[model samples]
Target: MNWKDIPGLDGVESPGLLIDADAVQQNIDRMIEIVGGPDHVDRLFPHVKTHKIPEITRMQVDAGITKFKAATLSEAQMAATAGAREVLIAHQLVGPKVDRLATLIDDFPNTQFAVLVDDPHAADAINQKCGDAENPLDAYIDIDCGMHRTGILLGNPSDALRAHLDSLSGLRYAGLHVYDGHLHDPDLQVRTEKVKEILGKVARHEQQHPSPRVIVGGSPTFGIWAAETSWHCSPGTTLLWDFGYGNAHPDLPMTVAAALISRVISKPGEGKICIDLGHKSISAEMPLEKRFQFPDLPDAQPIGQSEEHLVLQTPNAASLHVGDIVIAIPRHICPTVALHSHATVVRGGRVTGERWRVTARDR
Candidate 1:
């Protein structure tokens, strides 16, 4: 559907988030096409963390997506209730959340649930919680790819842990979960090579134990994953391309679905422009390159940020006046989306409708 068809574009309040429905749908279509168009063999479990809105998730479901990759138990439950048949909790379910985990399993009987774990203690906890049940919980051993954030270290010794989990009756080994956030690095060749290396290791592991399926891939690496002859890819960011990926792969069909629609709150002195959205809205974690594809407008750089303000410096500061809405694309889509509660659907420079509650925001 086009943006003009949406309900409240022209009247949307300034400093709110706007999601281009056309762009978002295109992002979903492009990612599905890149991943072999959602046949049973090839699964596209979008990480709900990128766009937590259940409406967006429903948009994907309407397009024939049944599985989802969630970052937390709450997201999984939300997705399941929204008609997502399979939910993979990409993060480890540990700490004191055993009751929460059990609650999810009991609540979503029709839904297939899985979680990732790098520690035996976590596996033991999950196994203990779901062990005697008629249905066992699926568990994927997260392997540490190039990024050291999560996952078990890849290679020889990790196989022992997998074997131990295999002995547990309450837990069924699902597969390997590898998130290549490090591959989102600007260097194209470096990212490609890293993904290839990680996938190769995963393939070798699969050759040894073929029961649990191998799932790998993230938003930035989705295109690179399309050419893979083996392994499954879980791509989330493609659903909502941000400034960082847009700068890297401009040719990709996905558009900036979520933009911080901020008005020029302040324009003090030469070459400086301030907006109402700051670290609280758009994330400052991802760095921006000085160069940009958009013409006329100077490279927007985040010089400083506070709770409710983004301090940016641009060359054409004189061209921008206070009260003009500047659509600022975020560097990273996940955290940036988590900061906002609703996104206005816009088309042709006007707000069309409102999509409330990006469902997967919390936990």
Candidate 2:
């Protein structure tokens, strides 16, 4: 059996997520390697939003990755519970989440928790929530490089926000969190140049503000930031590589560790077959055809998908019978992992019957 193929896949349930433990370990090694080595492991602050499994967090912790970046409060809490020394909730907190952040800080005294603040309103809110605590919450200024998704703009806006944060009673200015997720050009040279440009702007801002630390880049620019010794690199998708990233970023040698198990449910027509896999199981953010890939039926065309059914048009569909198992590699693994409560663990090309819960899957 191929390394990607599960040995006892027939025994496993359909429309389930499968995690290759060996491949995960290999990817972890590759991540540490990209960031230099064991000596430079402290520079690796991996994002926990990808896997969302506390077991994987523990694996990273055991491998000497003490720091983590999370997109949600639950992810941050899961990382803290998994023995992370430091966990940063990378998203800006709002609503009653401010109180939750305070509670998380109080709940995990051993772990240092930080969050991103792009405005004074957010800073003051955090201050009001946890200002009087014995240890105030550490805050990082989220700089919007070009994504414009979050973070303050590079120049006056960021400077003003920094000064405002200094005046806040609760949130302390720790550093800058620059995520250039927008610089995902297929060409490494193009991406590198873009990263350099973003860093140049950040350098000028840091010169004025004197930030103590900095965390930069996601999976696309991971290698570039890894070369920069001063900045911390947070790449989440490297843990469980997906077809979307792997195909676009061939320079990254990370393996696709996660896959989906589905079975033929019906033969609707001569050239069409329906599978148990559907939008509810895998991440459907991409186009219908690009959502998942069938290694067994490489030429399979994903014609339609419903809540619990995916119809495929493939000449090879005639060869497959009802109840026959098929494996699919998700193009987007993060949200796909969240759709499932647990992932069936595979080791050495065999199903281990052990399942790892997606601990922080829910917001």
Report the Cα RMSD per candidate.
3.3, 1.3
Whole-model lDDT, candidate 1?
Answer: 0.73
The most accurate candidate by lDDT is: 2
Q: Candidate 2: list runs displaced more than 4 Å.
A: 1-5
Q: Please, what are the lDDT tens digits per residue for candidate 1 over residues 1-363?
A: 333233554466655676777777888888778777657424676788777778788888888888888888778878888888889888887766666878887888888888888888888998987665456788888888878888778766467778878888888778778778776666767777887887777777667666457777777787777667445668777877776787876645677776666678898768998878756776656553431112234477667777788767888788888876665556677777787877876655556554577666777
TM-score for each prediction? Answer: 0.87, 0.97
lDDT of all predictions: 0.73, 0.89
lDDT of 2 by residue, 238-315 (tens): 999999999999999899999999999999999999999989999989889889888888899988999999999999
Candidate 1 residue runs with Cα over 4 Å from true position? 1-10, 38-41, 185-187, 250-252, 270-273, 286-296, 299-303, 311-321, 347-350
